[model samples]
Target: MSEFLIVLLAGVASGALNAIGGGGTFVALPALVALGVPPVTANAVSRVALVPGSVASAWVYRREIKQVEGVATRDLTVVGVLGGSVGAGLLLALPASSFDAAVPWLIAFATVALACGPRLSRTLASSRGRAAVLSPRVLLAGQFLLGVYGGYFGGAVGILMMALWSVGTGLDAATGNPMRTAQVTAVYLSATVLFLTASNALSVPGHLTALLTGAVAGGFAGAHLGRRMPARLLQGVVLTTATAMTVLYFLRG
Candidate 1:
């Protein structure tokens, strides 16, 4: 029961983080690992379990979704799907030890990104002028790479996407968040398909069920709550959670 509750709470927190910013994997992945799942399998299972919540969050923002300035939404989605599939394949093909060793660094990078994202976005916005850079081709290429990363680990992928757009296009994070949610959903959607067919993600049915159920509930609730919460409060909550998770992972390593 204790383990079940811990997994459920992690799912809820992960769902909220994804909905609010983009650090869900930082919560979900480590939680599963703490419960004795192998790192690679945890990654696979996290991707699969979080899909419904991502989709739900995207659905909540559907009406707000719009084409980012200087970028083609349709083309980006295509590249996202393709890149996500490739990332998922690589995850299954790679040795388990490789992923285990990389876990600490991945979490560290993600935690720093989450912590610095807002300030970095602001700095880029101020100095870069409000003009969008990157031609359509370059933008598509960048999105593909980000999609690959999102599919592979997905810790701070949403924040990464927002950072890219903020630096390249001068688009504000608030304005681009809906699109971020959609693209993340796309990445997870493709990754989930691969995991379902090619991975052992479902071998632990109990953990999967608990996390998925909590994630879905959290997704719905977070979407509604996000609109009402102060932006600073949300950021503080996400940053605190991310910092603690990063420290824990480093210690475990």
Candidate 2:
């Protein structure tokens, strides 16, 4: 019961944070692992469980979805789905030891990405009139790579996407957030399908259920709250959570 409560709280935080910015996995993944789920399996389960939450967040932003100037929404989603599939395949095919060895680094990378994304976005947003430096093809390729990373671990994927767009096209991260939520849903949706079919994510249904239930409520609420909530406040919360988790994971490793 205590474990269930922990997972539930984690899920609520995860879903809310994802809706607000993109660091939910930093909350959910560690909770699962701490509860005795293997790192890789925990990742798979988190991906599988968070799909609905992301979908809910996406639904809230549906009408507000904006397009990247150079990359078509459909095209970006296609690459994300494809890239996610490839990454999922790699996760399932690789041995657990490899994932174990990689988990700390993955978390660290995500923490760094989360820490820097907004700054990068702000820096580039200031110079917005410069012609987009990346062509559509290049942007699509970058999205694909990010999808791979998202599928494999999915910590700060939404922020990373915004960062990529900011770097390549000078899009303001805040301006691109609604679309980022939508793209994150696509990436998670694709990974969820793969994890459900090919991974042992369902081995522990109780924890997953708790997480899912909390996430659904949190996702819905967060989407609504996001309109009123300050972005910097949420980012600070997520950054702190991610930073602490990164340190803990490194120490444990």
For each candidate, what TM-score against the reference?
0.84, 0.85
Q: Tell me how far candidate 2 lies from the true structure as C-alpha RMSD in angstroms.
A: 3.1
lDDT of each: 0.78, 0.80
Q: Model 2 off-target regions past 4 Å? A: 96-129, 230-253
- Tens digit per residue, CA lDDT, model 1, 154-199: 6667766766665566565566667888999999999999899989
- Kindly report which residue stretches of model 1 are placed more than 4 angstroms away from their true locations once superposed: 96-130, 230-253
Candidate 2 on 134-170: residue-level lDDT in tens? 6899999999988987887777777778767766776
Return the clash pairs for model 1, or none.
none
